[model samples]
Target chain A: MSNGVDNNRRHFLTVATSVVGGIGVAAMAAPFLASLRPSARARLAGAPVEVDVSKMDEGERITLSWRGRPIHVVRRGEDAIERLGEIRDRLRDPDSDSSDQPEYAKNEYRSLKPEYLVMVAVCTHLGCSPSFHPDPADPAMGSDWPGGYFCACHGSRFDLAGRVYRGVPAPTNMDIPPHRFVDDNTLIVGEDAEVA
Target chain B: MQNKSNQGGGTVGDWINDRLPYRQFVEDQLTGYYAPKNFNFWYFFGSLALLVLVIQIVTGIFLTMSYKPSADGAFASVEYIMRDVEWGWLIRYMHSTGASMFFLVVYLHMFRGLMYGSYKKPRELLWIFGMLIYVVLMAEAFFGYLLPWGQMSYWGAQVIISLFSVLPGIGEPLAIWIRGDYLISDVTLNRFFALHVVALPLVLIGLIFFHLVALRQTGSNNPDGIEIKENKGPDGKPVDGIPFHPYYTVKDIVGVGVFLALFFAIVFFAPTFLDLFLKPANFIPADPLQTPEYVPPVWYFTPFYAILAAIPDQVGGVIAMGLAILVLFAMPWIDRHPVKSIRYRSFLYKALLMSFAFGFIVLGYLGLKPATTLYNELALRFTEFYFMFFIISWVYSEPRSRNYYYGAFAIVVALIAVIDLVRDMAGISWIALLVMIAVTAFFLLLPAHTRLNESKPVPERLTS
Candidate 1:
């Protein structure tokens, strides 16, 4: 046994082989790790989208694609803004305290301005885009509806401020993306600004 | 076959042995693998999970041969397979039913581990690997469900993906990137198809391989919850362990027969029972413009979904759901009791385990229902009970008297019976009845908590 090999030599060989094997295994895993990241097309598609809310009529909502997701830009009318106050008691997050919104938009309205309510069109409940039901007395919404968005999929209702209704399946208010007004009518979604 | 030769048997086994240690490999994994002789009914699920996995892979390969992944053709293709392709319905049903049974077997397997404390020292890696397999199995199930492109599949995917969008800034964009489109469209279906067929399955197989390797290194935990290795025979073999080949192999064959009987029953007799497994809304093709009136995931995902729905905050619900699954990995550290089996655990621990199991079933049922006021309230209550089991199991691991456990068990059994009776009279769905039966069986089947009542004690010696 001594003539064949010594203990020191066996120990050195074992250490050498283990180190080499470890490196080989790690090298084999590199490509799989690299494959997990989003592809070039996905990254390009994720670039911030720009929408023009300039000609949007009062109480009318326009949905545009931002990062391939529907972005709701609703120009709230005076009636809609007033009704937001009425639905305060009935909202799950009336103060927007538990809502997911930019810091500037964390008020009752959950937006940069009171009139322009910018939010992700997707429902907070399950991602189904909610239909814009602005009229309080819209036959489908019934009387005392207090205009907002309604998710027909699971009956999750939200007020005009994007605040989820108390009895609705949606937990919090609709997500408010960070958006800054390039100007009064020129609205840039997905970019934040300093609100004085 | 020239078996007379001394150097080799001159057969295929010898032929392979000449090139590689094929016989040695078989011996190491099968014939020579030592398992405890005290394994019982709960022990069968590990092998049964492997069998269902093989069934899935085989049926999946055939389904992919004809199943279309495109949005327009995906729903129609499932119909075509059901009606046009010969024996395609059988293959499709096998895969579908096999998915449910895979979870059924795995949950029981994991429960067996929990009951016996199989995740204890030296076997931590084995448990983690098992957890990884469980998670990947869920991913596989989720991705595969999208292939049907039915209404439930589409909206269910939508709701689940939206959970990711609950994240503050990048959430919405991230969800879109995952879907590869604005909604669950052809791009989303195609990507999910790629993941379902290629990515997740490979990870699953790799994890399972490691899981087996780790389990082989540690041997197996027994019903007695004692380490068989501590008491060895003169030949350095575990005193109570039997060679896994003829003993457990034969036992596992019985498990396979029983499992297959139930699996085939679901496939052949109740393939389209919406309440049992499949959802009725899934028959319609996916329509992005119109959302289904009622949308719920398959039964397996309902517990987490219920927890998700119970929370009033979007991010909070997501976190709770995530924790519900991830918390299982911490069981090893959480349960610091010296004993491995619940047989030696305190009464409180046993009670906690029962409550946790019952709450899980209730949460699952509530998750399937629409978020009515009553359902949401009940879900929230059960979620609290569900999470409390883990916390209590960890904090109170000290042993207590058997009399206390018996009292706790009696109370629980009585409570379950009362609830079952009330729900029955109230005209609850068949699912409630099924849960009642499962709960009754769970309580009735509990192993003895004291030495005197123990039906099968750990073997004192390994017999030939």
Candidate 2:
């Protein structure tokens, strides 16, 4: 090669070096980024939780913790279940279409069993747990209130079936976890019915 | 000059000066820096903001020594710091109070910019740097908020993080990545602690340095908005300028003393500021299974939160809230008027600015209350007014666009009335609609009958 500068060779080397350096930097970043994902301990902590609902009376609800989220198990009375059908037309997703749930729980109840409503209590809008207002005419909820969930965070309302009402901030129905009934009163959340 | 000569002649000083541009930097940034001599009461906030930043950092370092960062231990550790650690309550109160005061001064500083047109032309980059500092400060405040591990902290974080998940496709994954788990748990707290104490503070300080450097480059904008550099003296210094060291340094020291008195009064007496700074719900430890009866973000964030609540749709609300903050960054380009200060701007512009400020306060007030139908309606009206101020500024920046401004204002009022009718047909709703229409007509018709569009002639020199 001549003593003069070889522009083409230098350009190629510069581009090649930059490309290699960029790739090397990206490769080094992979582990650090991956480290931010849910660790093994966190994953193990999210293991299926079993909740007993035998002693729960009609219109009573108990909150359970599963995967660091509030899981609500409400023992619905006959009247509450009937009111669910009455308010179907007013719900944004009454049929549970476009909402989250297992195939077995995608029906009208949004649960494996119609009587026991086991679903994630978190609001789909901003994740505040919706308070259960099971009374069909709660008076505080208003005249047209048909027993369901009402989130005070942004006034998002849900039907007795945990179906979101129209014109609320929450876009979808309350999420139904991968839940199934182990026996008459035992409910297992975070695991599909098929797993049993 | 005497002190400089005495210090410079010293052997050690000479050795250091040779190695580093120490004296030159101080002179260039402080003693030699020529700033506007016409600064008013509004000018004190910038220096006060720096003071608050220093307070936050120093107190933060001390608190971290005794505070834990885990989900389990964080709440208890904070209590321990309050009860067990000597003088920790005072330090914690200062830090907490300092956070609010930081926002308070920064807001006033920003308002000063709006009044004086500090974000125009040569100082656009400076304004951008300042905006970046504001954004980082917000993130810093947010991350620190979760360190208390209280009910409000947990649920508030939940609401904010979930805002990211409103986007299609990547939203859920992005939120999951941010939390480092399915929910706001131990991992999330750990990472947030790292970010709050280490990452964001570093970014804030770096952004502040750049903000100052950019400010010095273009010099400071004043109330008169005149370029002092245009009229230089025989010595090549601006005639309307004064050395920042002796003039502003002494002035700011007095401002600092007064500010510290007020700051300490709050720290010692009403540190919680009647549950505005340290929210009552935050006193309780975080329970993942239960959300508080109401979950409103702190006062500083409420105005934007109100904007979010005003919109009925989740995605739309989230986008609107994000735009509310992001729109501030565009202020440098949004108002295209030639006038640098509100003093010379038209009556319409002043009214719009006042309305915008008033609407922001209304939104903040509405945000604190429950999202009832009435509050939501009010919030929606003010939210429209809030966003419209920017549009009106751009539209009515020139005298020729007078008709366009009226047309836009009328359309907005009509839309609000229609929305009110559609949402509620009650007597009160109709009355609200009537009042809105009357107010709009008054403002619009009043301008038509008067010379509201006429702008005063700008002065050549800065005036005290």
Candidate 3:
């Protein structure tokens, strides 16, 4: 049993390394991603980056970095929009499980708008950054793997609502950090206490 | 701890401590670094790559001094160097063409690594770091190319930068932000110039140092495909090995010196001598409304460039290109063949290399294009084959040396290709493509499923 614990630690470290590496690709990319450095002072001044979502078509995700972390704000597909209306027995948290948000965010979809699902893209389990495993039935993930955050760490699964799957290593759903839209294209995080 | 042991007027303990603790250990192992006798011209490519890296750094440092990061001065500065600066033309070509030569050495180096099991355990870091070097070199080139802010440079960057648009959410904003505005503009150019000229070079140097360190630790895996570590001769030295210090270094200098002469020639006489050098039309400030006619990357980048451009989907193309390079790292573990050398690999593996080579050349040709239907289709087809060959050749090539006859034929076919490339470039109108196709055919015709008769001697005949 002690030997098993050691092996588990080794496995944990291995998984952590891959997660770090995968995210490292994105993190290292931040500095060089844009031709211009996001002026340190201006960014530190805490102004939200204004995006033009006017051209963004539905069902597409546009990634934005908030303070160096990837904020994947995906527009819901028609089916996903409908799926949110019909919460099933699969979600471990029957009604948006963790109340880690303010009163305004305690909703089925857990967002300011029904069409857009905004959540901190990092996985709740082991902090291994989760990939938005949007397609529920992707063979690479599995049949039961719902359309959600499939953390490569310990194979944890979360639903599209960011609710953790039962029996998953992830003890809770992904954090939906407080964010409110200043305009249709502009989102301000760490502000608007209701959204925060 | 090691430096303190000096003998002069010092105690025995102090004297012993002055030398590297490994002095005797390294000695016992003959420094454990030696090159095999059979390592031929192909073996020199890695060191040649190192040579170009040095050339690039030296020339790049000088270029950086005069190079302005802003778009307004970037193009003019390049022109200034070409027209005014003494030997500025040489510096520019040396940098530009050095990019191509760097790829040549790396591809050959990678091929050398593949042929030998250089990615095997204990030395895996070497190959991994080498792969990092390759990645840095590419990023370095891409960043530097933007410094000139040429038409193709701008638009090519535009198309590549836009690949991020496929990300599910935030893609548009990220893409926009990445451009620093709506498109690849002056802001993008200046920052890219800094990263290209300064940031990426630092990363490349660091990666190269690690790569060489790892390589020295394991020593070179020679043509014989034997691990010198497994057997030590009576003299406690690698039997078929030669010291890298004076012996191979002197020999490698000939390769390096000749390469340098060619380097000087490209730098001075024909800075963009080969239209492959891509003249300054690429340097004109980028106009978003007008895309350059036939926008293609530098020739060396063409194959993977072709593969990326050929993908029908934006995100798919980017992922495919990234995976293509990443896939090389797994070559050691994935190549299940018991035999290390291609000379001994069954008919399938030999065929795979040639096909991969052919696919690479075709993909390269396609990458430098506007992606017409025909070219796009061909590029896509070759892309599949490019990936499939890596997967197949890596998995299938166990040496059943009774098939040595097949191996010889395949090698001869590859040789014919080299000859064809030479003769055509020599203005002989030789059908290089057809020969390369025939090389691919050599792999396609492999009798992998056929059971060989054991009575076959499979003797020393396979070794050149």
Candidate 4:
């Protein structure tokens, strides 16, 4: 019963089929792997976008699209800028130590300038877009609420500089994308001057 | 030889058996396999879980034929499948509902193991394999969740992926590598599709194979929590065991029937019942800029999600949530009680099991709500009790005297009285009174009854 009558033949056939099957599986996986890469159209759209902030009034905010993300640019009023100092102690990383931002924006304001703020609108906690509550009296935030961003998705709070408040679900401050001013009222997002 | 002639059953049967050994495989796994005759309704979940797995795989294959993985087309493709494809809605619902049912049956199956100490010494590998399957099943569910490219899918993936970044040095880079992009974009969706459809499923099937193989090698545990293999008949078979084919096969068919009735009731009639299995927020396309007002995970994941949300710090929350699942892996070591079945253990063990189950359900419910003060507090307390059930049961499973029981009861009653007195000047509520009475009765009478029951001794022969 142990005798297969043709041992050499059986071994050769087994090895051949095994090798062919392995090759076939490998070949089949190629298309699936190729499909997982981002497509050309998506890659093209991921390029930098330009925004016109000239018409945006002072103390007003505008949302611009860049690579399918919302880039928030705010022209802070004198009051909002002044209140940023008072809310510094409440910020988790007031000095931007553990935040995702460019080197030029590492100052206390977390922006290129003290007057204007540019940052991604998405919350760092879970990628929820926070609503802009420029008015300190916003009722949902309760008393002593400073003018800033509020994420209703998970109760993550951020200041006017997009600095996350301490003890929030958000681990760090919202990311400030690589951006620089092209002119007095024009701005470009998703690329700095060197990269552009 | 005589065996050679006996193997030649019929021309066609012999022809296939010579090549494949099909008959022997079936006989070994089913017809010749032995199972306990005393298996109860709790044992049905193992076979039911297998049925649900098959349903998920078949439905998922069909879904992949029409589903798109790209972000732009994924949402529209799902709607297209619902609106345009032939009976696509049913297939989709079956797959979705099958996901929940898979977890449902698995949880019950795990509970059966817990009740009977199925993870004891010889079966430790089997339990570890089972836990690995559970973990892979979770990864499969998570990866599949992101394929729809809906709002909840997007944000759920966002929150879960960011958990990796809580590590110190390479955390941020590792997260970017996983996403294959800066954020959860088309690349992330594509990779998740690969994982959900191919990679994790392969691992799950492999682990399931090992789980079954280990189970068959060790045989099965019974409600009596004793080794039936020790009491073999003259025929070299367990005297308490019967052939799995005609006996358990037929019984499992009945299980299948009852399970299908409930499963089809969900699939055909109330596929969207209660909105816990399939959230409405998932209907909208993934919007990176705008997150949903609330982002609770599905019902199966809410218990762990509650644990994650209950903590204030990211790293602590991640560790706690991880430990909640990983704790089950240490069950064999944690529950050092010699007795296998809950029936033989003291009522304290039963009470702990009951409290753990309740705490799990309450945490899941709280996880569905937005993180608020009251809900968060409750979640935190429940999470503590959840862990305490494991710790206390492990450290204090030894039997105690009536004095210890009486002392514990007095302490509990005094605590309840203090709380009641603080609540209102009115007399104790009827609910509290009933609970107190029930506790007193359980402590005073049930212990004696249980002691007598344990002392009554195990039957010399199988009775069921």
Candidate 5:
């Protein structure tokens, strides 16, 4: 088989074909790529978002964004509810914890609402979020350690109440912030809703 | 043949300085290429598929320049592309729609391969490499879909990555590392970006090169099962093959043109990728605590989707799903026909081919709807038939060039092969025997020369 004309023919074909195909592809891909940016900008602005938590129930958690940080609003479960006393004794700073937390926010529950625990999910130890091991004996956080949060990060454990397990890399309990109820159910992050 | 001076020549031939060089040896093999004579339009699909992969990567890079891989920014950045950036909407749609188009071309390419027995012996390595590329493409697309962090992207990855938990020991940790956190977080997003933009794409490019080199080396298997290489006509070309230049170039353009028109329709209109059936919750970012009801995998994987949904929910079931994929890798080994096309085969072979084609379409459909206890479960087992039928058909059809004996043996094998297994599964081997007998008897009653009376030749190659 001989193709003395093959290379020249292939060249002409490839250039014309690739150009046409390339242009069509470039044109087709234009909008799909374009649709990816608006959200990036909205996220970069790190807007102080409002949460319309009207539909949330006693056990439901609502998540909202504030400063690109994920804020978890969980209605604390009963096991964590009953272990408050034991958690304080084991935590580095118990009752109202340390100066690092706000006074109004420092309660046995350490939250704006005793039922709703609004805290960032990130682990204080190296920044990995402790998984919600809400089940006991985790084999990860260990037995007799009632289910709470386990930072599969470096084995840091938080009690059902977010109090740090003794000897873990995380020193203080998961921080509960200063916040106020805006209305019956709605809540706002990054601002004191009560005063506003 | 042995030149002592050139004997030491390295790959570059410079190492053989005393006598000869290696470049000539390499160059000589690739020169004087000739395409087949009878080749027409069917050949264009392979090249078209290659074209799609190239488009996907180049457009993908453009998307990365502005795509921020963080949940906080992913959803919004997509929006900015539409409302803020200049002609950004077009680029974004191109990428999204381009994904669908990629699959369309690859499917056609795969089917073409199947018809011509392109996966046969000397070309097994080529087929395996191509299949591996197909697997990687699946992974790359799966991960790429998730970067948007939209509901589909979120739940899609969430569902797919969670499939790992089906495995023991490293299940939980593996899932975590894959997500790069307790759940899909910024870390996972960023790392996935690196892979999507740099790592996977690089590997994908390398594999594609291998795919073509292997394909060309084996030469495209022709429909007639003949190596037309040695039969070049006066034009110094394979009587059956054509140069991939002007003939294929002008031909494939029509396919490319139609594909682009459909792509623009999706971008200019349904940029959200959500329709009445697709839903809008997918537009919302994924929430970890809430698992969406009726979550479905992307459409391409629907065939196996039916199979997975059909099985009883247990760890064993998931293994079956994984096996289903690996099962495809064995396809080249399974097809034992001496002939490439079923055109010359006995009656039994044609029937088996028909069953497989029908089964494939059924499995794909079943993957789309919600799994049902009644029809879906039964359909699930048929998924096994989908593959078993292929092997059974091949094992029976080959080795017998005659009609009556081939048909009779196919039935005998099906009975002997599946009887015990069916009985054990249902405690009713008797019923299984009856069904097998009935099918075999039905085919036997037909005249021996039926297949030959109606078989069509392969369609022409390179249609304008």
Candidate 6:
């Protein structure tokens, strides 16, 4: 068998066969792997959500689902708006530099308008929604607790303006959703003010 | 090989045996297979693990019959199984309990390997196959957990899936790809169902086949850690070895009986195993918008979970958690000491092994609880202890390299102290400082300690 064997031809054939087989397997796997991604229905479900914000009072917060996440629309009072500036020094990202938000909402208040904070209520730590506690110095939140959202899951805290406090598990400020007010009574989430 | 005629003179069984090598295979893998006679209580867990695997597969098949794989109906389907389906509660609880028990038995089995140095030399491939089984089992459990579609299930999946997003560049896209949606939705649940029921189970069974093959190739490592094959008698069989069929099979049956007694007790009585197997919050249906007050992975995963929670940084936590599991795969290469078992090993090695096990249990306990300041601090210390075990094992692997061991100990202690100081420059923890000092002193003085209390010389023959 070893006499006058075409070793080079056999090697070439083996390599050619292997490469073709590899490509065939990968091509077969493509659609199956792609099938695991978000379907068309799931993508379409991520439409813009509009909420009526006219009835919301000072320090009142309402949670609405946008893209399967809790979008918190908080109508902050004069005291809460002032408190955001007061607690800027305690925040991890006071200016929302590293946090996610629209280009227009990237400010100290982390919103398009100063009085209304439209943010993703999910904790940046592990995606748990933080409960809104707007009152300053709430008894359960402690004496020096500047009114903020507190996550019971891992104890991450975000201030009234959605800026995360230092030394918490959360890495950055709560994300501000791309949102805008169509009228005094109407607010739309998932669409930017500039885009609208 | 030519077919050998049966002694029973061409009966119906002989006809089948002649066609297929069923009788030969049974004889080769079971009756003719030789195992060490000195396999003590620790050996029971391996067979028990196999038994639990069978239980899980059978019960899991039953579960899939009635279980709905959807975001909306999954929770309701589980409740329906518990109430409506005939003996469904028994099957479901058995499976849930079996999942926990599977980890329990596998953990003990791995510990048995550690104690007997089963991962050393020829058995390394066997150990690697076992580790692969463990990794696949974790994936199976993770995917199965999402099937319940409860609050804890949703949020736990949410947190764990989000961990992938902590990576730098492709993190976000990778996480989205995993979930099949923006969040844990119907798509995620359905894919997870396919993986849990089909993909991972097939992989697990294949890995188990390889694991058993590797085990047979190397033969079984016993409590004595001596090679039985080295001492064959006039009959060409190991004098200290027994056939696996009548001997070990009977012994394993006794183990299975006791295991099943305890297993069914939990299944019938405390299926949730005092809420450790199943969380209370899981009874409630999944709410995407509102996460439960506390979200924790099942108890089996708590040790690694604690390691993740101990690290303050997001990316750092994820990396540490990953390393904690991946480090186990390197166990075969880590301890290069001549001694194979704890019995003949130095007191320092035994002590280190015990401390490592203790730290693991402590980490597991801490992981289930809320991450308070004190718990987190303790968890960090234990996590340090966990990794230190491997380093210390390598350092003391050879007694001749005493000077090198000392240098390594100094570097390790200094590194720990520096990391502690850098992490908390504002206030240095006294507990961490003490732990660092104690660990430094212990390792630096290991040479003297080993000299005073020397390792017992290994005997050529197995001890009963």
Best by TM-score: 6
- Pick out the ten consecutive residues of candidate 4 chain B with the lowest summed lDDT: B419-428
- Per-candidate TM-scores read 0.73, 0.94, 0.61, 0.82, 0.61, 0.96
The superposed Cα distance between candidate 2 and the true structure at residue B2, in angstroms, equals: 25
Question: Model 6: which docking level applies?
Answer: medium
Residue B6 C-alpha lDDT in model 2: 53
Model 4, residue A195: what's the lDDT? 32
Query: Please, what are the lDDT tens digits per residue for candidate 3 over residues A32-127?
Result: 655353454435544555555556666676666554345667777778767765646655664665536545666777778877776666544323
Off by over 4 Å in 4: A1-46, A191-196, B1-11, B397-464
Worst 10 residues of 1 chain A by lDDT: A33-42
Poorest lDDT segment (10 consecutive residues) of candidate 5 chain A: A34-43
Per-prediction DockQ, in order? Answer: 0.19, 0.62, 0.03, 0.21, 0.02, 0.62
Top-scoring candidate (lDDT): 2
**Model 2: per-residue lDDT, tens digit, A39-80?**
888777878999889999999988888887898999998887
Model 3 regions more than 4 Å off: A1-196, B1-32, B394-464
**After best superposition, candidate 3 residue B88: deviation in angstroms?**
1.8
Query: In model 2, which regions exceed 4 Å deviation?
Result: A1-3, A194-196, B1-10, B401-449
**iRMSD (1 decimal) for each model:** 6.9, 2.7, 18.0, 8.0, 15.1, 1.9
Docking class of 5: incorrect
Model 5 chain B: weakest 10-residue lDDT segment is B419-428
lDDT on C-alpha atoms for all candidate structures: 0.78, 0.87, 0.65, 0.81, 0.63, 0.87
Q: Give the alpha carbon lDDT tens digit for every residue of B150-265 in model 3.
A: 67677667656655654658875786677565446676787677677777878877887787677767877766566765566788766667666567778888999888888777
Instruction: Quote model 2's TM-score.
Output: 0.94
Quality of candidate 1's docking, in CAPRI categories?
Answer: incorrect
Candidate 6 chain B: worst-modelled 10 consecutive residues by lDDT: B1-10
Worst window of 10 by summed lDDT in candidate 3 chain B: B453-462
